[model samples]
Target: MNGTATHRTVIIVGSGPTGLLLAGDLATAGVPVTLLEKRSHDISNLSRAFGVHARTLEQLDARGLADQLLATGDTITGLRAFDRLTLDLTTLESRFPFMLITPQYEVERLLERRAREAGVDFAYESEVVGLRQDADGVELEVRGADGTVAVRRAAYVVGADGHHSAVRREIGLDFPGVSVIKSLFLADVRLAERPEDVLTVNGAGDCFAMIASFGDGWYRVMGWDRHHEVADDVPIDLDEVKDVARRALGSDYGMHDARWLSRFHSDERQAPRYRVGRVFLAGDAAHIHSPAGGQGMNTGLQDAANLSWKLAAAVQGWAPDGLLDTYETERHPVGKAVLRSSGGLVRLARAQSPALRAVRALVSAVGNTVGPARRKALGQISGIGYRYPALRGAHRLTGTRVPDVALAGGRLHEALRGGRFVLITPDPQAYEDPGTRKDRLTVECWASGRRTTVLVRPDGYVAWAADAPDATAIEEAVAAAVG
Candidate 1:
């Protein structure tokens, strides 16, 4: 039951969205990447996620996938949270100001296609049974669909497997967290009557529920019953979903013809470390939280975006010292923040007592009326407000997300398509010979004629920015960042 060992520059232990993106980025950057997945070929998870947020859309746009994915779904500009607060995404500064309501499988299909085009070597039905990492490389014992065991060695391995990650288990990392909700029901059903809103959710009585379009005739519905607690193994019927929807969402919308149904629990957990030696974790393998904010998949995609370039740099031998460590440092805090925010949304939806309900209403009042509070909430939910930790004496813009601004050639996102560090300046001649890595850097001028010159990372965060372009400083910034 054993086969010979094989080697790859980087091995990814899952083919989910996160793993696919990371593998694609690495492969596109001319690094050898192999992806291992336990699932069979052509299998889809029935699309657990429906709403792709604005920030994630921007990430997709950078890879030339946003428009194609947008065609497969509908869009919503405002998101209703806990029934009272509506976060308006139309005011967001990115090119994508609204969330796309599509099945998760659409995203997977697109990402997988891109990954394939980028030359990612994929081994389907190859499950990671065990993982061990040393100083030089990581070793993975994989089991194929035929039950034959093989060993895969890689300079680095990323586990984007999921909440029940074999890589995390093999590595002995603690995923300490509590179950935020139990007996949660999710289903895809045909709704004879369409809801007024693109996304419908409510926290009424003992039920918390949400329903959104899958862009076809079916609607994706999710509900949790506070009074009727049951184990996940118990089968859920359409009538049960109808009852919950009636109570929580006010009406079932004449929902019929259940295509798929399941019951599960949501856990709020984050790994203490995203990286251990040469092994890394992304997506659900690193964090999981309530789906209240529609951030489960979005956050995972962002994690891949943040980690992929750093990984590419490391494998290509140009990454600055300790650049790999920033993956955990930058993302762990975001994961923790997501857990808190999504957990808070779940708790607010589950509030049963009069005092808690009043507090919820007060929060709603403030969030709806207060400008700063609303913007902050929108920022958190949309994933646009987050900024990485800035270096000492760095410019205020450093680590902040660079909005999709127009360049002399095209949009900023277009310039980032090849995963190169972008240096935007008013005077290109100032840094004509800045001694930066020419292959890894793309120089562009602002179409709006701005004076400041900014170095943007491949993942679309500001690495360094200067009010006025200085050749020495620009050279130093490029050398320090895009080495």
Candidate 2:
């Protein structure tokens, strides 16, 4: 193949959940997004990460894919501890209270479909070889099928590629973190044991086990075995993996017909900052951690959602450059917390000493007994624990995820689906002035049955809200955000 050239508003590297979701959002925002995937074929059955938390579900629901996901996925109430202790996450009270357990491949497929519907262009069998940032945009060198080379230019480039991201490398972002000491094995198999009372994480001598029930007769299981060394030259044996499972559970669990098997070494690395000039990194490119709480894929999806609107704002020229910097300010801390918590979780699970096991049992029992402790643990696993410091003021709901409130005509989420800053005010007259509408600023009038007005960003966080009657104050906050 020969050289070719193309142009797009945004060029997204990778076709994983993060890249596809951002492509869909940007396309929906009227930005032409070129999504390049190194893979030629559509991946239909990969099963790496499976847990989609409530917060992630809410984000997908806003994109109209929640119903499709819920249809094919298993709904888990909450995580279970060592033995009979079930956390009962149904008590969390999200419209999507339960964790949706679907494979990563399924989620990516759903996102690709949505992105296609939104008219996002996909360049498959294409690998990003090199990229350079210019004063105006980014120029990319891509290798396509048949060894054809092409040059593509875009206003912005997003690196949603995995841990070894070319985009991140091209921008020279340092990913600093330590790797785990122990290796863990994950397998999808049919278990002879009946469906358990909860997803189990057992603490046994020299090992720890985590298992989740999946669709069909298959169950996804992970465990650490000191005696087992992963060999890349040899395929994982079902019998060998079964032996590890039995030892980890301290019992002979009948496991058969292993579907997928692999070993993983954990890394708690993250890019020091998410944005590097006109190029940005999201998902695994920005952060990678142990799959302790099943937050890997969900965290990446949220990262894409957060970054997409900012890219859209930049393309439209309504967003200040400072507004884009807020992505790192808000998401970097979340990534760090994820790394810390995931590392702590792995350490806790792998503590093998008799005294350490006893201490862990006592702590788990005590924490389960207390409401605040239970809520805190649930929040950590579910990702509802994040609160950005940038949002501050009189708004009763500032710095919080905007609730899916019911308005006169529809859900509040409907008004925000188009990727624009929405100003919700009791009196529309204040923001209705023609001057505010000149710069692609969208103002919607809603009677919240209160004197206050709420301004929400495209990522579903409240920028500001007014508790008092003065429209002037609320207008100021909205004006600043929209500006």
Who wins the TM-score comparison?
1
**Total clashing pairs for each candidate:** 0, 0
Candidate 1 lDDT tens digits, 1-483: 122233338888888888998899888998888889898887464768888998999899999999999999999998876667778889988888888999999999999999999988899989888777787888889999889888888888898999999988888999999998877889999998999887887877677788988878878999888888889899889999999999987899999999899999989999989998888889999999998879999999999999999988988889999999999999999999999999998887788899988888888989999999888888889999999999799899999999999998899999999899999999868676445477799999999879999999999999999998679889888889887
Could you give me the TM-score of model 1 versus the true structure? 0.97
Model 1 collision count: 0
Q: What is the lDDT of residue 269 in candidate 1?
A: 91
**Regions of model 2 farther than 4 Å from truth:** 1-8, 82-86, 231-234, 250-254, 353-366, 391-396, 427-450
Error (Å) of candidate 2 at residue 174 is 2.2
Give the per-residue lDDT of model 2 (tens digit) for 1-483: 112233338999988999999999998987888899898866856467878998888888777778888877788786766543457788775677788877777788899888999988888998889998877889889999989889889889999999999999989888999886446777888878754533656766666776666676677887767655454345566776666667666543578888788777778899987888789999999999988788888899989988898888788777764888888888888888888877776766666788877766775887679888788777777877576775434445777787666655576667666667777766667665457544344576664676567778887787887755475775567667776
User: What pairs collide in candidate 2?
Assistant: none
